[model samples]
Target: MTKKIFASIVTICGISVMAVMLLITALLNGKTADSAAGHVRNESRLIASAVEKGGSDYLYHTDFDKDMRVTWIDSGGKVRFDSHKDADSLENHADREEVAAALKTGEGSSSRYSETIMKKTVNYAVRLSDGSVIRVSGVHSSFTAQLLKLINPILLILAAAALFSALAASMVSRNIVKPINDIDLEHPDAQKSYKELAPLLEKLRTQNSKVSRQMDEIQSRREQFSLMTESMTEGLIIADPKLMVLACNTAALKLLGAGDFHKGQSIYSLNNSDIFRRCLLNALGGRRSECILRTGGGQREVIASPANSIDMVCGLVVFIMDVTEKQELETMRREFTSNVSHELKTPLTTIYGTADMLASGMVQSDDVAQFGENIRGEAERLINLINDIISLSKLDEDSAPRENENVELFALAEEILDRLKLSAEEKNITVSLTGENVSMPGSRTILSEVLYNLCDNAIKYNVSGGRLDVKIAHAPQRAIITVADTGIGIPKQHIGRIFERFYRVDKSRSRKIKGTGLGLSIVKHGIMYHNGTVRVDSEADKGTVFTIELPIEKKNNEQGEII
Candidate 1:
């Protein structure tokens, strides 16, 4: 900016100076030409008067310089005297305009002409006492020749002065522009110090400082907001008026499979699930909405709210929550309620029938005692089923792990195998343990319960003469425990719900075997409480394998103890 202004100022000053110099030079040159012409005319008049006073002999014999040519014309328009040539041979000057004007007005004058010997002629007319007109004619070169001689030095001096003034003006302008160019708009302390620019620079510094501070404050606020968004468990996304992704949180990226969500990427492209797309469109139209979206891997319940007045400029902020587990729990709860009612009804019916038979004396004396025992056993089974249900409900409510304690995984597995060995022996099934000793951080009671349940289930479901494999191994970062059984293998459809509370592959068969469906659910909850995962793989009539993985060392809590 400074350079541009300097160039403009310098250019204007240079042009003005040059113009004034040229104008003055032209005027002076004109005046000089006029003065020189006047001098020549005076010289011509003096010579003509001298010649007229002294007669024809004085004019004809006059000894002026050779550079000056003199001639005289009579009233008859004939040349009377000539210095350069004979009077009889000279052309008549009476017809010349200058000579005629001088003759009639008795005044001398000059005019330009083209002739053989002269470009211009100056004439002086004097009437002598003898009543004969004496006109003296002198020829000279063009006026341009004399003007050049007079003005050349003046023109050269003016040209030199103009050049010097231009050079000086450029230097001064550069000095004035340099500091201004170096002034930093980003830093208020760095600015021009010249007195002329002080006020403007000060104002600029104040405005720049204010803007910089405002930008810094906004940046700080943005960082805090980003931190809050990242820390949230729910996935968040913000879109533009066109339903394009503008901002997203860490949870959103994870939920969306770490997909790119840069500017101009349509919200629908992030997840093509129909429900998600509808939510995005509805939010963009300023409507708060919600939808459950199931993707390839998981399901998300999204709650979209139109942004407040500040964020209405774009679209809206959509909150996403992973509700797959919650939905499964709700389904399990409904199924559990229905199953418990059915299960209790069957045992209660048996007890009621047996007691009525005894009360009615329908059974023999010997069978009555047996019937009473059968009713007691059925009542006990009902009590156990109710207790298991209560325990499962508690585990579900307290999903968080308790304080961690080191537990011997191999010992726990061995104990569970011992407890179920008798049942396995009755069915002619063998229970075998494999792998090395392993230790993990978890509640001993929970670990023992998980192993007991898994082993019992394995034995109960195993076919006669089948084998059960209980393996405990140490992995890179976790302890793996697997229970595999050659049992009446679960169907593919039933495998997914096997760990759900009160779910059974064959309700009648499970009841005949005195199998409590809560076993697998208990195992699942125990493993989950230990911050572990349980997965099952099975094939119909082939076998079923249940694998549990638990971290070796639990994460430390804020109090610096394992949690």
Candidate 2:
């Protein structure tokens, strides 16, 4: 700024001085021309007086110098005599401007230039007393030649002016800028260095105060927003129209698996999914878009919504939510509906068929009891399936707080084993109970269901005369329950899926066994409600063992007794 200011001032000063110099030169040129013409007039008077006193012969005998030429012309436009040339051979002077002017005006003067000699001539013609004209001409150098003669001196003067201008401009520029440079921006009104700048400085001081306040407010809001988002589970992202990330929370980075993220980096680089990037770009194009991006073994809902201002999309705010549980629940609902429909349809069909036969008298007297039995049996199966579904629905809600009652684990196992003994006898399977007598804290109903499902499944899947065992024990921190059956065990591939609703290892075998597929699924959910884990060990044609572990809660630290 300093250099530019100095240079501009110097340039302006130099140009002003040069302009004045040029004007003066033009004025001098005009004055010189006028003086030259006046000098010719003065010299012409002498020659004219001499001509009036002497005849044409007296003018022809006088010597004329190389700078001056003398001509005498008669009133009839004939050249009567010349001073430097032969008078008889000279052209007529009647067509000359000065000769014609003198004849009309008595005295006239004019200027002309000779191209061959490159010089200007000034002529003064005065009319003689005999109706003749006497002309005296003088030659001078051209204007361009005069300027060439003065070039060195003019350049020397301009150089000296330039040096002075540089010094003066520098001093003036510094004075003009000194007040501004010395201004105390933090406290503008503290000192009055320059009166002219007082108003400007005060205004700056006021604006600075306002700007500082506004900046503080903006910074406060930013910090508040960051604090609020830091601990949020949902991912939040703010990006620009170019899909560059502007702000992203920790959750957003972790959600998108953005390992190394930075501001101004493209959001498309956050993930490998083409569709997700497309959604982000679409949001930038003034549209809201959503996509389910599977990440980290779970589903995430990526919603890209345009942030609009005055009906135009300025940027994007993407919200990512962990929707894994929601999506899983939806899938489970769909599967449950389908399974219920099919499971209910089969038993209802059987019941309807048998009842219809009986109502129409299709069964004879001997077969009537058997048909009635079939209808009752199908109805019972349908009832059990409905109960299992109701239990699963309750578990799915997870809203039911269990009873705060302690349950005797061994006693509950024994009771469940007793209830299943009759069924085990029908299959000729030996049922036995083993392990230590232990207890846990839980709802009695839920604990009963857990034992009954395990023992029932053991009996249901056991081979003819196969052995079934229920074991109960206590670990240092938990209670353990084991149900093992020597039966057609689960296939290794299907073992993991056995707890899913309606998942059968062998459909045909399950049909002959006449068991609801929800029994084990119910057991799994019910045990989980009590904070337990269940694992299975099985091999086809070998045997299967189901083991459960539930955290133990002792009523008294010293007593270690049940409540």
Reference-based TM-score of each model: 0.52, 0.71
Q: lDDT value for candidate 2?
A: 0.83
Clashing pairs for predicted structure model 2, backbone only: none
Residue 561 of model 1 has an lDDT of 10
Backbone steric clashes in candidate 1, count: 0
Q: Against the correct fold, how does model 2 do in TM-score?
A: 0.71
Candidate 1: C-alpha lDDT: 0.75
Candidate 1 lDDT over residue span 1-563, tens digit each:
54565567667766775577567656765675465467556666777677656767777466865655666777666877776789898777777775677567765566566655435655555544443455445555544444455466656765776577567766877787777677776663433456777777778879988998999999999999999999998998887677777878889877766576665687776677777778777776778889987766587888888765764645678888898889887887788889889889989999999999989989999897799899998999899888777767777788444746889888888888888778989999988999999988878877887888888877888899999999999999899998999998989888777877777788878867885579888887777676677778888887889888887877533211111
Local distance difference test, each candidate? 0.75, 0.83
lDDT of candidate 2 over 1-563, digit per residue (tens): 77888999889878987777666666766777787788778877788889899876678678767677888888977887777788899888878899999988888888888777767899999998999988888876666656666678768878988899899988988898887788888888636577877788889999999999999999999999999888899999898777788988999888877787787898877886888978887887888899999987589999999999998888999999989999997997799789889999999999999999999988999999999899889999999998888887787677546578778888888888888778988999998888887877777887788788878888888889899988888899899888999988888888777888898888987888786789888887777778778888989888899888888873321211110
Please report the candidate that would top lDDT against the real structure.
Answer: 2
Q: Model 1: residues >4 Å from true position, as ranges? A: 1-196, 227-233, 240-245, 257-260, 264-274, 277-287, 310-315, 352-374, 397-455, 462-498, 506-508, 527-563
What is the Cα root-mean-square deviation between model 2 and the actual structure?
6.9
Residue-level error in angstroms, candidate 2, position 539: 3.2
Q: What TM-score does candidate 1 reach? A: 0.52
